[model samples]
Target: MSSQASLRPAVVLSLVLVVWALTGLTHAQPKASVLDFSASLGNLLPSLSRPANSSRIFYGVMFDAGSTGTRIHVYTFIQKDPEELPVLDNEMFHSIKPGLSAYADMPEMGGYTVRQLLKVAKKTVPRLEWKRTPLVLKATAGLRLLPSEKSQALLEQVQDVFDESPFFVPDDSVSIMNGTNEGILAWVTVNFLTGHLYAETRETVGILDLGGGSTQITFLPKSKKTIGSSPDDYIARIDMFNSTYELYTHRTCIKYLLCHVIHRPPYIIVLLYTPGLEWRVFKSSCLPKKFREEWSFGGLTYIVSGKPDGESYVGYKLCYQEVLKVVKDIVHQPYELKDTSVFYAFSYYFDRAVDAGLIDRTQGGMLEVRDFKKRAKEVCNKMSKYRPINPFLCMDMTYITCLLKDGFGFKENTVLQLTKKVNNVETSWALGATFNHFQNLKIHR
Candidate 1:
């Protein structure tokens, strides 16, 4: 949400902040301890005097500048005990579509979106608390995919807007969030809220998040092999809840050749890929036979479609073979993922499951690896029934199945609990990001 410090991003800070928020540090202090700011149970922060009997209340404002939309999260935290962590009391959320990147050529318009979202903070935070409530903005795939000059121009405009706001504007308040931190933050939100971070037995669930622009797989591996076998960049040693965890996380992007050109979805089969990509037409068996069109996203045009009529028989078999090639060596398989891990999947994973009647739309339920396989088979084979609802349903469903089985190497029986939110908070990086920045936890990377 809002942070007062600027330091090298660390997975440790992201995981530890929520624990500090929910349960006061009962365990050992993190290797990455809190900032020098004084801690008190009260309104505002940093050495503010308060009535001894009054409870502590803190406010924060975070703006998520994502590819599809810009969302604002206004969080209220309360502390009733000095020895325990602060409890998340309430959250006020809002958003605007066609993210700031759409206004790259007209930077002021993008500033207006940030300006408009600021009003939510103005209303939610008490008048006297405005000066203390920190405001921050972190852009994701949308801005990161833009040219450096254009992205910088847009960020400058956002800065001007932040300067005009009444809330606290920390250093480096507006910037693009890297893919690695994005993955770690999502893991923090789910694990912290789910009560795993505080458990004495120390069981934590892995997180799978798929957006239109990126996908993340994050979990604490039980075996040293999962850590040693992974590429260095894919493994992060994070100190949290008084323990050190070597996490295996990856965010994917489509850059490989598919048919000669690329089928660039800022994500799919889900991911963020190599930067400085060239625009090209893409062809794949990932679409319906009757589907063919020029699609545009993230300021680039991509021509995508299923295999031509009569060219090839398209089914889950052909689709998996086509999609499997993208993640062969790119995604690292964790040791004993199927037997040793508990997972919660969200984002595109949830939406597509709901779309295919695999899970309830309102209340998401537990699903196994084979459930997705079963659903993928039905959709990929019966395109005529599902295509009108979403032409990409077959492709996306197929991608989810393949990625889970092949990319992550989960057995067919791996159970995945998919949810859109925990308690009332969204199951997303925003809540975790808020804590990541909200607390000035600058742990060593």
Candidate 2:
């Protein structure tokens, strides 16, 4: 009987221990479930899902074949995640003068120029990333002015060079950019670099680009009058980054209207024509009354003079009238320009501002439209003395002033930020075009 009682006590203690362990485990199950739910919730958030270092870093190579020079931009970018836009980390820029157009007759020479630039790209971009980095060459007004066959020959040569390179090349890698597309891309570049593209407030700026063969003006028109008054071809709708933008674009010979007059009506009608050095002397009232010299543009040289007969009219008032004819009725004035909208003028605009001492060469500054007018008057009146400095200063200044005040119809006090670069990157269309190319390919992912 004593042995049986002892065995019963041991069995009862064992059952109690088993019950206690089961109860503890059931209570702990809810805690384990909560921990797993919290982890999944964290993963649903982009920031918590992956760290910044988890993003892939890549590179891009872009060549800007402009009228005066050819430049290469090697860019490094980082994508935080497959769903995010790539961030531009840095850029390596280099250029060579006497652009690809200089080699129009000798296509091989043009290819050689591109080949040399590829070396720079090869050195700048990581060797391991070469196959992933896209190489693109975009020719601007320089090639646009060339004969179609000649332009094609040059582009073909560039394509051959690109094919030989180790970098990635797209099918439409080498081509001439239309003036309208050029302006729009430039606008995107400036806005994107300025952080205006992603701002919560959605602020954006206008862009003015003056090239050797053509000039462009682009801005988002807030006023209905601007859209209504503009011609059908002047307005363009661009879809980017899940947003649509209506932009106003205009192209013309900077400060002068080219072409012989066909007819004279309320406005002069003329077909756009390209003038060559064969016509030795070109006259303009914007030139100094006593100045005459040899000037070159777009691979053509011309003996430009004030007048063949006598001293040319050199005054802001006279120059304004001459320049006004080029843009008066053709360019639609934006109503919101009177008070709103900021403009970033670059290329020839920036160069001219620097030459006129209006802004620093490296660190650019802002100026009012009136500032250009004031400088134009001073330069035009003193042309006889300043001719040695820069024979075209008077003409260039007057043209910029008239283009802004009479051509585009900005108020005198309206501000214009003149810069060649924003943050370290050049404010050119190449960067934006690079972004467009990669986005189209979905390479960021």
Q: Which candidate should be chosen as best, given lDDT against the real structure?
A: 1
lDDT of 2 by residue, 44-111 (tens): 12342466557655677899998767899887665555345445677778888878988999999999
lDDT of each: 0.70, 0.68
For residue 124, give model 2's deviation from the true position in Å: 1.8
Tens-digit lDDT string for candidate 1 (117-216): 8988888889887776778899987788788999999999999998887776766678898877877888878887787877777789999876653457
Candidate 1, residue 363: lDDT = 86
What is the TM-score (0 to 1) of candidate 1? 0.81
Best by TM-score: 1
How far is each candidate from the true structure, as Cα RMSD in Å? Answer: 7.1, 18.8
Q: Count the backbone clashes (under 3 Å) in each candidate.
A: 13, 0
Q: Tell me how far the alpha carbon of residue 49 in candidate 2 is from the true structure, in angstroms, after superposition.
A: 10
